[model samples]
Target: MERWPALELASTIRHDGDGGVTDDLATVQGTTRWIRAQSDLPAGHAPAGDIAADEELRTEIVALRRAVRALFARAVSPAPPSPADARRLMPADQALAHLNAVAAREPVAPQMDWPLDGAPVTRLLSAEDDPKVRFLAALARAAVEFLSGPQRTRLRACTAPRCVRYFVQSHGRQEWCKPSCGNRARAARHYRRQRTAADGGPAPGGPS
Candidate 1:
């Protein structure tokens, strides 16, 4: 199974300074759809049927998102806590509990198979139709692999101001998630220097 999509699921919400920018997977059905779109589903197997529109499922999805976010915090520096008035979306303990439960679910197993060249290979297989459980298990397992893999060092949180997303650094000089974010960061820096100059002071981060 592809691990990147499961890792991407952890980014459903983007943490900002005071608030967070949430993606579209805010509901049970939406989460299910996202999983289907991201996961390697079998041929002719439908994903929408497994998803249900219910409060319980919604709660699970929200909890899962929070758990993933909390896990991500372990790998990257997280934003500061929201103010008292703003709801603390994901408590550390709660997220941990949910993640543990998800991890407890059975993982997708590898099937022994051989190609036409008789080369040995193992194929990951999953027959579960329960999108919630399946995705939870898949994501939890993927998280373990990701955190332990060499690629973990490449995982980075986007440093662009107000951008709350994580990305795998593809190049040595890559910093932001995308070129647009890099551009924004550069623009923000230039603006800050100009503002400092206008204030009759040395530009921030510049020569004294």
Candidate 2:
């Protein structure tokens, strides 16, 4: 039998809905937890409190999850001075660091930057056997689509004066939360001054 935690996470990911914040949070947390449980899930081995007592398996699973997350984060949101960014930040998935490196070593290359990575991330570590690696890799691609495609323009940081979370807009017309961030942001300037004075100086990070 598999651990309940892992199964619970699977359930969370499989949920279907409009994927609101509650949905997104549950999905993200489930995905994160599941990535951490890779080794255990593959074999019949799960951690003890894991409900399976598979120490070695759990260790390996954690490693796999970490790898996938690394690739996913890299693919989805790699750091700057970055190879992926050097290439067109569109058509998203074709820029795996490993693939770019392999292409570079070939003698017959094009003149136009053949993927424009003046200095790319060279160390590539991944397992050919893990299915999760592919799964997450694909997910990273979809995430990029959500980020750079039209959906990206729809992403808005809470306009709420004090809220710092981001939310996806449906109808392409929404902004900030209807309850918290939205109302808070709508408060008049006088109210903002009063709130600022009462809180003793622009609420920590100060107005952005």
TM-score of each: 0.73, 0.33
lDDT of 1 by residue, 102-151 (tens): 76675556787877889876666676656656655666666556666777
Predictions in order: lDDT: 0.63, 0.36
Point to the candidate with the largest TM-score.
Answer: 1
Q: Candidate 2 residues 1-208, lDDT tens each?
A: 2232222221221213232222222233434445454443221222222223234433433333223233333432422211212243323244344333322332221123234756433322333333433333333333333434554444444454444333446655566534644565657556877888797787534684
RMSD of 1: 4.9
Q: On a 0 to 100 scale, what is the lDDT of residue 141 in model 2?
A: 33
Q: Against the true structure, candidate 2 has what lDDT?
A: 0.36
After superposition, the stretches of candidate 1 with alpha carbons farther than 4 Å from their true spots are 1-3, 14-20, 40-53, 77-97, 107-110, 124-131
- Cα shift from native, residue 79, model 1 (Å): 10
Model 1 lDDT on a 0 to 1 scale: 0.63
